[model samples]
Every structure is written in structure tokens, then in C-alpha cells.
Target: MSVAATRRLNLVTEPILPRIRPAIAALAPYKQGKQAGPDAFKLSSNENPFEPLPSVLEALQRTAPINRYPDATASRLRARLGVRYGVNVEQVHVASGSVSILQQLILATAAAGDEVIYAWRSFEAYPSLPLVAGATGVQVPLTADARHDLNAMADAVTDNTRAIILCTPNNPTGPIITSAEFTAFVERVPADVLVILDEAYAEFVTVPDAVDGLAERVYEKHPNVVVLRTFSKAYGLAGLRVGYAIGHEKVLDSARTTGIPLSVTSAAENAGIASLDAEAELLERVAVIVERRTRLLEGLRAAGWDVPDSQANFVWLPTGERTDEIAAAFVANDLVVRPFSGDGIRISVGEEASIDRVISVATSVR
Candidate 1:
């Protein structure tokens, strides 16, 4: 086309483009977990280092035709989870991952003027989901020790608040909210505001007083409560990408209505079933992780790294401004750990061998 024709076309298009939704333009894309090299020790993303249980492996080997579509309702897996959790099948919904369910939950319940409440520096996805849903994000700052301040979180709730997400044994930080505190918080929260109890790391936590708020008790009494769990962590099925939400039928129905893609793959469903069946075996691996987490913390403390008492499968090194130096040193030693802020590096507790290598690198860096 001639220069004048092209100029006129551009002028017309520019005005039309400005009419696009402001929310879409202002939104930030979700940043995914860090990647690790083949030869490096990857402690990013808080994944279980354990191989899939033999049963899960066998199930995958027996994989059916991938050419066919998956069960949109995911009936068999839902049935098994219902029986396991003692909830009606209608109360449970499965998704490719807990993150997908979280996104669906946000979209279903919140609108442009509504709000989604969560802790800062918690799950990286927490803030992004609200922006995508065109909802305001109320991020309460973490307490000095890096735990969620439930009181402040509850106080932040306003008439516009539609949902609150709580990540127990919080990622990056590792402190868990007690049952009593959560119970009190819930009682104060408005009945209509949905509280999402994200228990993705629950299976790894072994505290006697540790709040397993996602247990059947909460769901039974609180119609507004929803618990999210995943096979990605303790079940060691991260590659399979299966997670589920347990809540009242009404709440689940709203989330399901958002239309999760039907083809979640039959392989993921089979893997989940196999993992659930191998619970005892998976727990054994979890025990090892717990032990490693303890030893790793003790080691870091002895080396004067000021580590927190982490219940998750990873330990955080709060080095403040030295975070970059520390993380760079690990990379120099051919190790990979997730770094956050200028002071924190989350190192996953892997196999005994990998743990030793990480410890050595940390010691050298220090």
C-alpha cells in the first residue's frame, strides 16, 4: 500500500486498540518456577525428589489410548477421592493442578469490583489470579518471622472481599498457622467470603499441633470453606500434574462452571489413583524428607545461616543482600536453588546425596 494509505490504516487501528479492556492491559503474566540444568541439583519449585511409586509407574505403563478424549467429569477418580475423604463425590473437583483450580475459583466468584485476599510473598500465583479475574488483590504483609498474620488478614476484609486464600506451612517461609488461630479467623470472616485453605504441602508436615484445617471437620461445618491438595508434592506425581479441591457442592459447582478444558488426559487421572493407593509408601518417603529438612536446618544454623524451622521439603537461607552472592556461588558450584528477594534462597531437601552436595555448596558459599 502507499505511505498515506498505511498511515491512515494505522491511525484507525490505534484508536480501536485503546478500547481493549484496561484490566487486560494492566495485568502481569504469571512467572513460572525456575528451571534447573540436567547436571545441576534443582531445589526450585518445592517438588518432591522421590520417584513415582512402583504402582504409579505400572499404571503409566498400562496407559490407554491417548488419541481418545478424557472423562470431562473425571468420574472414577472423583469417586475414589470422595470415598477417601468421606465427602460426597459432588463435593470434590479435580483439575490439572491446584493452580488451575485456584484460577477457576477466582474467575467464578469474583468480579471487576470485588477483592481477593492473600499473604504477600506467599504463592507467586496468588496475586496474578486476582488480576486475571479483574479483582482487587489485598496482600497482607507477612509477620516478622515470615508467617501469615491471620488477624491482619481478617481485618483487611471489606464488603468487597470475595475470597481469602491461606497457604499453610506457607511456601518460601515454612511456618504453619495453628488450628486454633485458623478457627478463630474463620469465625470472624463473613459467611459469604469463601476461604480457600491451600494445603498443597500438607502431607510433608508432621507437627503434632500442626493445623490440618483442610480435614473433614472444617468442610463439614463451614459451607464456605474449600481445601486444595495436590499429588505433586508428597505423592511425587508433579510430572503428572493432578490436584483437587474439596468443598461444598455449591461452591464447587461455581468453579466447575468456568469450564476447565475437558481433555485433562486419562494418564493424569490414573496416576492420581495409583498415588492414592500407595499412600503408606509415599508417607515413608515423606518421613525421610522430614528428617532431611531437620538436618539441613541444623546444618545451616551451625554454619550460622539463620534458617527458619521449615516444615516443607525445602529450607530457606535468609542472607539479605548476600542472597545474590550466595545463589551465584551455588550456581558456580553447579547447583541450582530458587532465590527470592535479596536475602532468601529456598533449597529443596532432595536425596541424601543431593542434600550433602547442597550443604557443601552452602558451606563453601558462607
Candidate 2:
């Protein structure tokens, strides 16, 4: 942060962004935790604590020639997913992660001067995707308790609004919008404007009122609706990077066309199919995560810290200005928790030992 340090950092001689697309230049690089090293206990990216199931590992081992091109259509994975979800194969499109799929959707639908709406504290990808697609972003403030103010978001719609991203059990704050709320909001949104329900953490949520009927809601009722999901979280396959989106065939077609790399890698495709087959095993891991999340919430609260009722695999520390201090303390203890603007620290629920480290560090904070 010193001028001398800044000067040292400025040694690169490319005019910072020389000749890059203006849109690309405008993006500050995405920050993730430091990769493996002696001091790394990364609980930053909200990955599941469990390793890939035995079936998934076996599938990977049995996979044939890596040099050969993958199935362009990802036919086997698509067929399995479609059958499992009771939807037509055309309705589902797979990508590296939900992030890629999201980018493709924005590129397909948004253009210069158009507006894309999402909650202020929702997925970090929401803002970047719209901007990268050459559209303006409309960030609505969260409600009093850190939940999406769906009514206000609906009111933000304008003639130029092309899409709205609703991140359920919202990242860093795990509150889900009710089905009634979504229904009401959907009714108000224009038919031409796409409404994306990002359910990356869907498996972690246990609320009765929470909406998990994303496939049905999007594919059956609303032509403009798109649902994004991932195998990274509950399925324990973040490294494999397989995610999917379900929408009307036409909307899915647009994403397929715009998405890079043609399809998810064959390894990821095979892993996804194997993951589906291990649903029971994955659900058991999910149950453990839910239990651990409960313990984390209760422990944090009992230690006199204010925390939200989380339905996701992570807990939010909404202490605003204290975030830096907390994150520093965590780092000192060899744990890495994500810090956001104001006083937010998102700590992923990991194994008991990792959770204990977080609790210990948090409790030691003055």
C-alpha cells in the first residue's frame, strides 16, 4: 500500500490494459483464496467438505483417451439429467460452471445500454457478467435483515431491463425467497426480460417455504425464466467444474450457441453422470453440512457475535468494518475466510476441524 510498493508493482510495461477490449479492461480480476501452500486452510470458495464419491472416482479412472474430443452434445450426461429432472434434453445445457453458463446467457440476451438487475449483495458474478456482456447493471439494496427485497427489485424494472438474476439462499447471506414472493415478482417482470434463478446452493437449503421447483417454474411456466445449478457444491466436484442451466428450449439454444468450448469436458460430463448416480451418498454429505452449519451458527451466536440464520453451507459475519480485522485474525490462525465490503466475512462450513479453527479464531477476536 506504500508509494514505493506501488511503484514496484507498476514495473509491468503494457499501459495497464493496452489495446484490450474496453469491457475486459473495466473488470478487476476475480479474487480467490491462495492455492495450496503451508499456511492454506482455504474456506473461501464455499466448496463442499466431502471428496468426490467412489462412483465418481471410478468413472474418472475408467474414462478413455483424453486426447480424443469430448461428446459435443454431452449426450449421455444430458440424457441422464433430463430423465432425472423429468425434462426434455433440449431444456438443459451443461457448462464448465454456472458462471460460464451465466456469461453465455447474458451475452445472448443483453447488449449495450440495456440494464440487468440483481441484488446488491448477491453473487459476485452477477455484476461482472452483465458488464462483460456490454449491459448496464442495476443493483438493488438488500432488505433490513439482509434478504433480497424482491418487491423493490421488481420495481427496478424499466423498459431497457433485459434480465434479472435472483440468487436464492443468496451468497454470503443464506436467506431464500419464498415461492409466493417469486411468483409475485415474476408476475410484475416483463415477459421479454429474462429472470435467472441461480440455485447453486439449492441442495443446502432446508426451508419448507424455499423454492426448489426451479426446473418446473422456469421450463413449464415462464418462457423467460432460466435456472442455473452446479455439481460443485453438494456433489463435491468443484475441481471437475460441471454445472448446468435449465430453461425454455429457445433460451437454452441461445446459451449453447454463445458458450465457449462447445461443451463441458468429457471428464466433467462423466463425473456429472456418476454424481447423479450417487445422489444418496451426496445427500448424506449435504446432511452433514447442514448439521455443521447449525453448529457454526449456534457457536458464533453463543460467542456473542451476530450471525444470520444460514440455510447454505456457509455463515455470514456481517460486522462490516470489522471484516478486515476478523479476516486477518483468521489468516493468522492459518485459515482463510472471504472478506467483502463493509464488515462481511463468508466462512465456508468445512470439516469439524476446520469449523473449530474458525470458531476458535472468531472467539479470540476482541
Candidate 3:
């Protein structure tokens, strides 16, 4: 075509592209654990294997009209959570999941040029959340035992640090930060800086001294601290997507402000409340997971694997250079496990048969 004709065609067809912020543009989105094939045990995501409680299904059946928007505050669920945790209703804030609350709190407190600190290799999402908020992420490396080095994390805090996330019974690794350790560490952090205890797996803890965020030593003494908990794990509500935070109303207010409106759906809210009502039976399930976790820990150790002692529903195998190879063996044996490249393998406590399969596969791989 002639230059004039080509120019006219370009003008008609060309469209301006929208610019994504460089921080987000370069950021990698969070990846959910890979789904497994039929007949395989899915030990990738730390999901509860049990079916939903009858009450939860009943409440879901009576969910508010889909045409109407959800309650902005999710008041009933939050109020129920408040009573269960011994906090006032305002102190409880509900979100689609604790991760959503994590994003909101970071947005509320940090921005470009500010910093948010968390342990490296804790939650996979932690590294990306700050970058999404246009804030810097400071990742303090965990100690040799696959546990957070409280001293290192405390020392890394700076004047520009706006928030710190502590994932107790830290995801993947499964070692708990003791109550005494947390108390001492929080004392060193600036009072105005936000400290988020991401306790998404709190219900599975069997350790006697694991830090309880709602207990007096954690939240009550520290005004800036907020605790995040989720129903997705122990309560078998992962599909429903409900989680909450408990803290000083003012601090939680910041997260509420930054949160996406009506993100917590009516069905999720009802499920959360119903789950609370069924807490006793749910904790029994948690007890079973803890028992299985103990068995898995002992079995792996007895087989000469140097895995960490976990208080969560998962165990960590420090396969290190052998991570991928061992994870592949498990997959071949119909066990889908989460593998962090060149790091470690996280095996969620799944069915009883899967436990035996895990030990057999790890032994074979070893």
C-alpha cells in the first residue's frame, strides 16, 4: 500500500495500551498450590481434607440474595468472632480471607518509599504484597532450623518500616515462634509500626507455648499488633473464603478503610458464623490433624529425615538440593506435595493412607 494509505490504516487500527505500575508490572502474582490428578492425594495446599460441617451447609442454603450486596461490616460474623476471641465486635474485622486482610493492612500503612518487613520463606504471598502496595519488602532470612530469627528481624527494622508480618507456625516450615520470643521482639519494634501476626493455621497448634495473638501477652499489651485467622484450614471452609482479624479497633479500622468494599460475600459471612457455632466439632478435627502431624513428624524422623517439628497441619522436609527429586517421587506415588525450588518440600497432613505413602516415598527417595 502507499504511505498515505498505510498511515490511514495504522490510525484506524492502532490503540493506546494502558500502563500498569512498574512495581506491579514486574511483580509475580501469588500461585495457588497445583491441583492433583484423580486418585492422587493432594498435599500441596494446606487445606482441610474433611467435608464442611452440616450447620455450615445449612447456613449457606439460607444465604442472602445474590442480587443484594453483602453487609459492608460483615457484622454478624465479626460479632461472633469477637465473642469467641474475647474481644469486642469492633475489634474484629472480617475479609474474604486473611490474605486479603494482609493486603489491606499493608495498603493502609505503607506506600511508595516505605518498607514492610516479613520473614523470607514464610508465606509465599508476603514477598509480593508489599510490592503490589508500591512499598519495599524487607525479607529477613530464617535461621538454620527453618524458623524465623527474631533477633535478625528486630534488628532489620528501620525508621521507614511501616509494617511487620509474623507468620507463626510459619507456612511451609511449620516452626512456631514461642510466646516469649514474640513478646521480646515486639518490645523492640516501634510502637507506631504495625505488626501483623498471620495465624492462618492457629487452630492446628499443639505446642504449649506457641504465641496466641488474642492472649493478653500479645494483642492486649501491644496497641499496634493485629492478629489474622482464617476458617479455610481447620473449619473446612476454603471454598467459602472467610477469615478475620482481631486487634485495637482503630488499627483494624485502617485495614477496613483500605479493604475492597463487599469483598466478603453473604455466603462467606454465614459460613464463618456457622463454623464458629461448630467450633467444638471442628477442633476435634484439628486434634486429629495434630495427631496425624505428630505421626508424620515421628515417622519422617525415624526414617532419618531431618524435618522440622511442626505445630501446624503440615510438615517441612529440608530436602534442600533434593527437594524437587523427593517431591517428584511423592508425585509418582500419588502424593502431590508443594516443593520450593532448591529450598524444601512442604507436605500437608492428608488422609491416613497418604501418611503411609509419604513415609514410603520419602524413604524410597532417601
Candidate 4:
């Protein structure tokens, strides 16, 4: 064959893969909080500073049957959560983490040509969750005070919108949606749309009027609402990866269809059960973190930093244009914080000793 003919044959023989979805190709992988070095504290992930209770550890140790797959439905844990939340077992859906449940809910409700609305600068994972499910993300800007502008978010809703995520004590920003505001917003949203209330940091909240998500049986009244919670924060089970959602049985049934079967291991389930069993002890630790957060906020404000009133375990430093520079200064001082360049920094309340260093760095930057 001629040279051109041979080249054509080679081209035909070469393997050519189908094009990847442009949305997936353009997506950035989730960036985890940076880890700290040997002498430094890792205040980036907003992890609970306290260790697991002895009962939790004991339950983890007692987990058996490594050779067998875990319960696909996490029945016992779900039942316990149902009892605690005053919902039926069918209303509880447990997953690897609240994030996983969020993803499942997105997949269950949204797809290409659909829109999932959420506040900008809320959870880092919120934007990406819809993308993975081939849904468009519509982000509403937060208020000047770093709180969700629920009214604006409601206004942004269109016929194509399928889901709305409301993250209370919103991650990185640390402001909770008030009960009255949330109820009013819920009323405005179309009943056909799914509203996910992410309460990952619920246990740390000291605000009396903050939307409880479950305390008022809002979910009971609104079949479209779902509340997501995690053991990772208050219960110190970040390593185990267990979270749950309370919603209408039909809605949870849809999410359950999207979940990865048996992804929640026996150990995680047992630990979660044990954590609930030791709730009082775990909450005492939450009290300590809350106290630290209060002091941290006071220090930041006194140092001339206009920080938001944080109901979560972390505080947001609105460094704006100086975000990168301020974050670097903290890193240099062995403090690892999550920085959204051109926006601000999120410093998790960590070890008691780490607070002094965090305050010093904030003071210097100011």
C-alpha cells in the first residue's frame, strides 16, 4: 500500500475512546482541607477536636464479620435515629456520609436540563454534587453578613429547578438560617422541588432561633423537605464516614435507590449507634468547642477583623483580596486553615493551645 494508505489503515486500527462529558471534564475534583505537620494543628476540615468516646471505640472494636458485607440498609442505626427524631424507620436514610446522601438525593431528583439551587460560598461540595448528576447549579450570592439570602434564592427559582440545598450554619461561613426565615422561604419554594437542609454542624449551634430542621416537625409537615446530619462533626466520627437523612418515606425511598449498597460498613454503623448511646458525653465535648468558638470570634472581632457570628465549630475570616496572603501567614505559623482565595479563610476551632496561635495570626494580618 502507499504511504498515505498505510497511515490511514493505522489510524483506523488505533483505539479511539468516546468523548467524556464536557461537564465532567471541566469539573474540579473536591479539594480536601490541608493536613498539618507534626507540631501543627489541622484547623482546616472543621473536624471535632475531641476523640471518640470509649463506648464508641469499644463498639468499633467489637464490630465483627469482616468477611461479610455490611447491612445494606443500616437498619439499627436508622431505627435509632428515627426514634430520636420521632420519625418512622422508613423516613431515615443512612449513607457513608451526609455528603453521600446529598449526592444520592441530587441523583434521585436532578439530571441534565434540571437546576439545583444553593447559596454561593456554602458547602464546598454543594456545587459539585449537582454536576456529578448532570444537573445545572444555580448559586445565589450570600448577603454582606455572610448569611444566605433566602429571598434572593427563592426569586432565582424557575420551572427547571428541581432541588434546593439549605445549609444551616453553612460551612466555612458559619451562619444558620433562622426558623422564621426558613419557614417563609420553604413556603415560597414550589412543593414539587426538593429542599435539602444540611445540618452537619447542628450539634454545635447555640442560637435559639436557628432552624432546627426537625425540632418543629417541619419535615413532617412538608413532604418535600429533607434534613441531613452527620456523625463526623459533633460525634467525632469523621474517620468512620456515617451520616443520615430524615425525610418523607417516599422521598427517602428514591434516594435509597441511588445509594451504593452496603457502602456503610458494620464498624461505622456500630460506632454511630454507640455515639448516639453516648450522646450526653459527646455533647459535652460540643460545649467545649462552642465555648472555644465564642472566644475565637471575640478575639477576631477585638483584633479588628469583621468576622461573622459563627454558629458552627469554625469561623470565617473575610480576608477578601488579602485571603491568600493571610492564609499563608497562618500556614507559616503552623496553622492550617481552609482559604477560598479572593473570598476569605475558614479556621476550624481545634486544640485549646491552637487558639492562641490562630488569634495571633489573625491579629497580625489585621
- For each candidate, what TM-score against the reference? 0.92, 0.93, 0.95, 0.95
Tens-place lDDT per residue, model 3, 188-306, is 99999999999988888878889988765367888899999998999988987888999889989899999989899999998888888888998998898888999899989988999
Global lDDT of each candidate:
0.85, 0.85, 0.90, 0.94
Could you give candidate 2's per-residue lDDT for residues 1-366 as a string of tens digits? Answer: 999998877886445545777877878877775553465677888988677777899999867578888887787888898898888999888888888888889999899999999997877777788888888999999987889999999999999999999988899788898888888889999899999898999999988888775634654887899998999898988998889988898999999899876457888888899899889988998999999999889889888887877888899888688878878888888887788857598889987788777887888894
**Candidate 4 lDDT over residue span 300-347, tens digit each:** 999999999999999999999999999999999999999999999999
| Collision count of model 1 | 1
Candidate 4 lands at a TM-score of 0.95
Error of 2 at 292 (Å): 0.3
Residue pair clashes in candidate 2:
320-342, 320-343
Clashing residue pairs in all predictions, respectively, total 1, 2, 0, 0
What TM-score quantifies how close candidate 2 is to the native fold?
A: 0.93
Query: Model 3: what TM-score?
Result: 0.95
Clashing pairs in 3: none
The 10 consecutive residues of candidate 2 with the worst lDDT sum are 32-41
